[model samples]
Target: MNPIDPQLPPGDPLVMLGLLASAILFAVGIVGFLSRRNMITMFLCTELMFQGAGLAMISYGRQHMDLSGQVFVIFILTVAAAEAALALGLVVLLYRRKETLSAEAWKELAES
Candidate 1:
């Protein structure tokens, strides 16, 4: 019987490492999103989630030899940029109103 090679090829190792990093980033983002009450921390967690998604997409693209995954990553980056802009605007508005950046202090809205 022939034994399979224990060492992974270069591509395989890179894919495995990317997947592991994505998983860790996802886990940490989830934890931060749930545990933090600050708006900035929540925003950071969202960015982390975006990063993990991008990593997974890039890894899959490499494995498949396709450009679609990279295109998707580009779209994700665009969306993340928009999200950051909007979030910062809202944070500024909130700070102006409450003089604080805590999530708990953002209960009232301009309409109410």
Candidate 2:
């Protein structure tokens, strides 16, 4: 009778809502990654996708009463942090040289 209890089955409305929200987040991330031409925005979109994956992993772990999903999220977070640091460094360096954050600026690096 506890609405907040996560014992709800796969058909539960709350579980369904979580899945829908995760899916929407993933879709938005993909769209943003594909449509955006800015390096920082695209990197942010990638983080959004990572967040969606982490949410789904945690939900599944909770449903199964397992801690592995939560554990995996820590790894995901670690990787995301590393990725953000490297990406931001690259963006900063590229911006300093080109004065813009556009993805097209990378082509110049490739030319040399």
Q: Pick the candidate with the highest TM-score.
A: 1
Deviating ranges (above 4 Å) for candidate 2:
1-10, 108-112
- Per-prediction TM-score to the true structure, in the order listed: 0.82, 0.81
As for candidate 1, its clashing pairs are: none
Writing each residue's lDDT as its tens digit, candidate 1 over 1-112 gives: 9666769544577877887888889889999998898888899999999999999898888788899989999999999999999998998898898888788775665466
Instruction: Return the number of clashes found in candidate 2.
Output: 0
- Report the Cα lDDT for candidate 1: 0.87
lDDT of 2 at 75: 95
The lDDT values for all models are 0.87, 0.86
Candidate 2 local lDDT, 14-107, one digit each (tens): 5566667778888999999999999999999999999888887777776677999899999999999999999999899989988999998677
lDDT over C-alpha atoms for residue 105 of model 1: 76
Indicate which candidate wins on lDDT.
1
Clashes of each: 0, 0
